[model samples]
Target: MQPITPFFMFEGNAEEAMNFYLSIFEGASISHITRYGANEVGKEGSVQQAIFTLNGQTFMCIDSPIKHDFTFTPALSLYITCDTEEEIDRLYGALSIGGAVLMPINAYPFTQKFAWFNDQFGVSWQLNLPGKGEGF
Candidate 1:
């Protein structure tokens, strides 16, 4: 397990969200998952807990058995440093579908290219093409 990992709680779409994220990042994978059983409060087959790796950063997610109005927020977001403009563009496009863009991809003084958006699952992400000798 990673020393520190982000944990997400979804109403019922944990599996779907996990797969969607895996599809977007290369080398991503579901390391393990434990689903709700017949007698559990959650619907059978729903994710009780899951461990996933986005490239190499590990994350934990679960399908919350109880309802809550809260969700992912922009205050805290997944920040990715892209290798090229094409990569940032591709990620921005794919993640922006069915979602909203907080900052459209464009050339910025801090970075050559940058974009910030919330994915369909309401997860906020910031993608950037780092400038020389710097990280975004």
Candidate 2:
């Protein structure tokens, strides 16, 4: 199966935030943090980034540099293709907690069932459940 993962950009506290996430989610594993050296793009010894895996999905995070413009937008949302209605509902509810819902979970013209929301972490997601005529 193909897995869809998201990469988030943090101001400078990526390590702390990622650690906090690992603490909240059971079975979350964080890889060792890597630093930039003279051979890298940024200043030597600067923290490069790390990767965190929750359940089986991987998320990559990095500290945003002064030169990079990092902003979260709806256009960059991560789509979760759910297999069942119950699964979709469960995830939709969990992700919507403490977050704003841009599109309520419901049936749409183009899709049988779909929901769009921005999670508490400022990440956008589009949850979709295929219809009768849909293809995987």
Candidate 3:
């Protein structure tokens, strides 16, 4: 089977969200982007499709032309295994702003530090620092 890449659909702010993520994560970059032109289905200059990588994990996203009643849900999240306290703290601070926290950063029995939240763009995320954690 081909490698599966995560995809995201944004109402109209896919570009903004992509840039925001690139700024926050190390080794993040936009690999490719196709913007809507004048009179296109989507808003002019908006992302029709974009490919980006965060810390080498590739993801696809788009500014959807069709408006829908639904958006991102917390059921599926992007999980990150952080290397240090500073790393998790920085990511949690950035991702949790203007978003709902499902679980605040704390030491749990399964992990030394962990947090789960939805980002400003409604993307769910979980940050973990494995120390005493059984599963790494």
Q: Identify the leading candidate in terms of TM-score.
A: 3
Q: What residue pairs clash in candidate 3, if any at all?
A: none
In candidate 3, what are the lDDT values of residues 29-115, reduced to their tens digit? 999999999998899999999999998899999999999999999899999999989999999999899999999999988889999
**What C-alpha lDDT does candidate 2 achieve relative to the native structure?**
0.77
- Residue 17 of model 3 has an lDDT of 94
**Per-candidate count of clashing residue pairs (backbone under 3 Å):** 0, 0, 0
Which parts of model 1 are misplaced by more than 4 Å? Answer: none
The 0-to-1 C-alpha lDDT of every candidate, in the order given, reads 0.90, 0.77, 0.93
Cα shift from native, residue 108, model 2 (Å):
1.1
Off by over 4 Å in 2: 1-6, 12-28, 34-48, 54-57, 65-70
* TM-score of predicted structure 1: 0.93
lDDT string for model 2 (60-103, tens) is: 88776565555678888878788789878988877777778999
Q: Give TM per candidate.
A: 0.93, 0.66, 0.95
Question: Could you tell me which 10 consecutive residues in candidate 3 have the lowest summed lDDT?
Answer: 127-136
